[model samples]
Target: MDVVLVSRTQAKLDATADEIRAQYPSRRVKCVRADFTDPDTSAVYSHVGRELHGLEVGVLVNNVGLSYPHPEYFLKAAEDRCGDADGGKAAASAGWGPQLFDDMVRCNITSMVNMCRLVMPGMADRKRGCVINIGSTASRIPCPLLTMYGATKKFVEKFSRELNTEYGGKGKHGTNITVQCVMPGYVATKMSKIARTSWLVPSPDTFVKSALQTTGLEPVTTGYFPHTLMVKAIELAESISESMMARTVMNNMLGIRARALRRLAKEQQQREEAQSATATDK
Candidate 1:
């Protein structure tokens, strides 16, 4: 079957399209460049719809998402720095602000809903289609530091299930639309910043293959076996004591946050030192 790939960067899209063509020479591949981070939702979806016009989109993957650069508390994340005219003080105090939250909602939640609306009607008319919404393990547990990101993914899980029920083989025409929410743990990808792969953390291609196998079979899944095990363990922990599980997760995320901040500080210091040396030499 032919494919239509939509993403923010044209160059990446072209490179991916080339790879697909190499694998399947006979199949057609089209690229549509649209950034989901755009606050103007209507215009973005409209452009995507125009680009996809006249094509029978049998499968829709709502995979575009955004997350915090590092885990942080909601209060700090939502701090409005607009009041600080110079912005330097607030920037020194906190690395994130209200705009980051807005972008997360727009990119993670709005994109999925809009894409489903734009593509599903065509599926209804045709009487068959599949949708894969990529969620995260963060949604399955109480993610303390990564609160907003987890909440957005939880939205994905709920929306996909409800939408599946609404359109799955119920109407007079029997529209067999399958909406599957795949809540996966870490995979070796740039987003997760993991270059090496293990049994627990598979490559993106491996994860996709496993996820696709469960399209019609499972409405919601972890997609990979190891990921399922991880969620199951988290569930067991919650069953024992919900508070304990929350605390455990929060502690782990706090450690990650600390390391990220330390790295950022080190980089900044190195830059300043280099600049100082350059000025002295001049």
Candidate 2:
């Protein structure tokens, strides 16, 4: 199976590619620097798989994201963080504090939609493909400080389910593209190094490995550990809220989240300084 992983950081791309190669030595695994945050995000990267490689994309994992340490300044930081991907004029209309919510909607939201749009034509042509969109647990419930971050992921979670129901019909285009949202509770990545102590955190690879397995089942796959089971057995459970809320108990969960944030930020600073020194040939 030929696979491509679109990652923002080259280091992460290399790590994931290495693992895939070790597991499936016979299969081709390609890693591309397709940062979703880039204003010039395009679908051609995905098209390259179908057109150039002579391989059908059996799976697509949309796992790109960002967040602010403090919720108090989330709106303020987002406007500057994200430039105008929607439009120069519409940016002001958004009425967000800085960068129209401090970041580019094009990268965060529009680009994902465009990628899916591009891949669907080919997947529908072949009647096989799976799209796994990595979202956040904040989408299902809510996190006070993670307002916009949560909202953006919520849109993605909702989109994947609808796409599964609407596009998976065999009659329309004879397509069997499985669309599933792979939202995780918390994981130890560079971004969330501050969120070090998640009750049921999985490594990046572990999270992807499981989510990839459930591509064809349904839209929503409850995030975290037992939560994933709760999603599958929602109807059998006594209450919808009771089954899912155990792992992500809120304030208690984020008890140490603030301190972790400080540590991660310090680590980021040291890395930046080291990179600068190296650039000067130190």
Ten contiguous residues minimizing lDDT sum, candidate 1: 82-91
> What is residue 252's positional error in candidate 1, in angstroms?
0.7
Residue lDDT tens for model 1, 128-201: 99999999988897789788999999999999999888888757746899999999999998888789999999
Q: What are the models' TM-scores?
A: 0.92, 0.67
| lDDT (10s digit) by residue, model 2, range 29-136 | 777666665554445445433443554666776666666543333543455432234223222222345544435355556657877876677787788888878776
Best by TM-score: 1
Rate residue 41 of model 1 by lDDT.
Answer: 84
Could you say which candidate leads in lDDT? 1
What lDDT does the true structure give each of the candidates? 0.86, 0.62
The TM-score, computed over Cα atoms with residue i paired to residue i, of candidate 2 is 0.67
